[model samples]
Target: MTRTPSVSVVFVCHDGAGRILLARRSTRARDEPGTWDCGAGALEFGETFEQAVAREVIEEYGTGPEKIELLGVRNVLRPGSHWVAIVFAVRLDPAEARIGEPHKFDELGWFDPAELPSPAHSQLPETVALFT
Candidate 1:
């Protein structure tokens, strides 16, 4: 079987306590529409892992390179494809960072480390654990 490879980026911000930024995907998305997800995308032909993560953050959240730190990576296989997510930690002023438009994300918000919402990816809990 041919495995489809994809990339995902998780943004964690720390204030007094840490919070994870979660996005609600649009209903028009090919997969998992209307579900909550982290900022993510697929790797292009010539892109490096860091480049892909950086690109995704900018594309999804308008974040720049200076704002992020690569945390680690996680490999998750679901059904027919494998996802290699490049995890990242970005410290942002919650009051300054706002969700951008024109992305698949319909809604955006910050969730406490222990209080994530439902319809979130199955691997998200494990992914978040690594940061704490």
Candidate 2:
């Protein structure tokens, strides 16, 4: 891969009450299979952060966001790859959330922020702190 970094729109979808949605990564996921994480996708060229987040939410969660709040940005660096993670907290209808991408995620769930699922993506804890 080239040394250039890409931009990713990472977001946590919530019910506006308290619970946040998470997806369990499947074996086909690029990394961290079996770990739970927020929804995310590449920032397609010419699209704004909100657009990317909205599109990703529907494509990943099968629901649209009622509200979107930018939490913060993160420079996510790993061994071989790096990306700029623009994080957001999105409010949506939890009842409509399902695993939109079956090849990438095997399961989906909503949990209290204080009691998120274990074996989370390595960056999850810090990312959650940016909002809650």
Candidate 3:
């Protein structure tokens, strides 16, 4: 069987202070429920990786890309599947960011780089390391 290829995005926002946005996954998600992850999601059919990243930001955070910088890409393989994620360094004014309804996430909040929560997944550590 041919496994489906998946793409995800990691959004990092900083203020020269040492913090990044992290979201708590909803229990309803198929995998890694309740884990803290950077804003991310799979690429939809007929969408470019960049388009998927922009769409995910709107769907999850209700914001558009105003000044997003491409960080790098990382390929990760789990036990049953693989992923290619485009990580981006994004800067959003805190005042303009409103947490969307928890349709896919239980909670969303910002965390200091030194105090990030545990159980990070999907190359999040690498993404964070790039920013810090």
User: Could you tell me the lDDT of residue 132 within candidate 1?
Assistant: 72
Better of 1 and 2 by TM-score: 2
Q: Scored by CA lDDT, what does every candidate get?
A: 0.69, 0.91, 0.73
Best first by lDDT, ranked = 2, 3, 1
Q: TM-scores for all candidates?
A: 0.76, 0.95, 0.81
Can you write out model 2's per-residue Cα lDDT over 6-116, one digit (the tens) per residue?
Answer: 999999888888888889999999999999999889999999999999999999888889999999999999998899999999998877889889999999988888887
Question: Candidate 3, residues 86-120: lDDT per residue as tens digits?
Answer: 78877766666656747668777788877778766
List where candidate 2 sits over 4 angstroms from the true fold.
Answer: none
Best by TM-score: 2
TM-score of 3: 0.81
The pairs that clash in candidate 2 are none
